[model samples]
Target: MAQRFGGKYSPSGQKPEKGTPSAGPMNTARVTPVGLRANLMFVPAGVLLLSSVFSGAGAMALGLIGAGVWTGGAVMLREGLKAEAAYNDRKVARRPALPRKILAAVLAAVGAALAALSAGSEPLLTPLYALAVGGLHLAAFGMDPLKNKGTEGLDAFQSSRVARIVDEAEAHLASMADAVKRARDRQVEARVEQFQATVRTMARTVEEDPRDLTAARKYLTVYLLGARDATVKFADIYARSQDAQARADYLALLDDLQSNFATKTETLLIEDRSDLGIEIDVLRERLEREGVHLDRNL
Candidate 1:
């Protein structure tokens, strides 16, 4: 009798052909207001450079200096925006140590002042142009984060430990991605990305409850490092041979790792919920003992 094809043993989704990897649409679109502004800055920078060609030595030097300072400001603004995005994504985060936006504004104002002075503008006009440019820049980009988020009353030592572990884990993930790129196989890339998603799930769970760090330390450190090394070795081997059996084995290993990571994250969440329930029960008992009747209906 022939075995039926629709059960646990069967492939669940549309499977790709052997040795052919599935590819998804790339997410190339991004919201980059700072980046757009930075690009637009090149227009003014080019104008300054052109102006320098027709001016005296003093003016030429000042024009070049102005262009350099303005360019630096644009670069700083872009980095500040990126840092802001990362800060916003986390439940707990530290504000950027340096105020990049403010510094950029200062640099832009100084650049404008230098240019005005070089062009033989009246002293009064030079200061006015500088102040106007600086004020406009401040208005356009606003300010950097001034306060830490969700860090009140938390244990500082524990938070720092969690941050260190997460940073190391992120490095491992980045290394894996870099190694996999050398293999030039879409399927391998997809396999790595799927595993990364599982890793991120676990990371988020830990972030929600830093107490879970004790339970998840090995998974975050040792296992991730091992995976990174394996990815590097696989990329080297596959680049030269493209061995089908090796590729299959690597992919199967990724599947197992992803499953385990996902399961561990779910377990941590369940435990957290159970702890919350116990706390609620204890609070209710205390309230009842104090003769405080709870109202079930509003």
Candidate 2:
């Protein structure tokens, strides 16, 4: 049965069976500084909970509140870092309007103050301790972006439209990612990641030229939505049956989508260059008509 459609003789061959985990670094979870900082909250949370055990009701309540607030702040800081990474990846981007890192630092400091008060610290020293903690937090993680980036001379309406489309495309990618997790196939996960990278390339191209959004709207929205639905369906089927053929076909689809997206992005970049050339030629003609003689090098 595996030989049908030249499956047994396919140039690429059959999919590898699930076996012991690979030792390759690619299989390992990425450990970022932000993730480590977020995880550190657990230690303080545990300490606060343990200290609460030996204290009165008021102290216990305050300690618990502090622990919860600290955890929330850590989560917020992690999200802010992730957002910052995404913003940095693009050639053009806007700063996050809310300063999440700053807010998180403030929350952590307030939590520290509450814990100090619970421990019966001197009232006058509590604020100082809180201020010190907050300062350290801000110094360590830094603040979120304070200004808009790469948005000079762009129309507000068009920029907003691009943002809306990109947001929707990102949601589709997220859905595809979540669905693929259910499949539990490393190859499939890698394939999805490849497709996502290509998709993001197209997205960045559109962002660099909002006019391209009209051309790319279907690819970003309709095609991505379809891919997400297909991934969800494929994950369900493969999870139950471990169907090799289905996996191969899905991977092939991803390859096609990736190729198309990459091609489209290249085309858009070429168009941008063409437009620049036309602008240069127009300026040169205008200078010539004005009887302004200039050196060829100039």
Top candidate, metric lDDT = 2
**lDDT of model 2 at position 273:** 94
Lowest-scoring 10 consecutive residues by lDDT in candidate 2? 19-28
Residues 41-158, candidate 1, lDDT per residue (tens digit)?
A: 5677678888988999989999999988988988887878777876776787678889888888888898899889888889889889999999998898878889988878767788
User: What's the true lDDT of residue 115 in model 2?
Assistant: 91
Runs with alpha carbons beyond 4 Å of true place in candidate 2:
1-33, 294-298
TM-score of 1: 0.80
Model 1 deviation from native, Cα RMSD in Å: 5.9
Candidate 2, 66: how far from true, in Å? 1.5
Off by over 4 Å in 1: 1-14, 17-34, 293-298
TM-score of each model, in listed order: 0.80, 0.86
TM-score computed on alpha carbons, candidate 2: 0.86
lDDT of 2: 0.83
Q: Residue 228 CA error for candidate 2 (Å)? A: 0.9
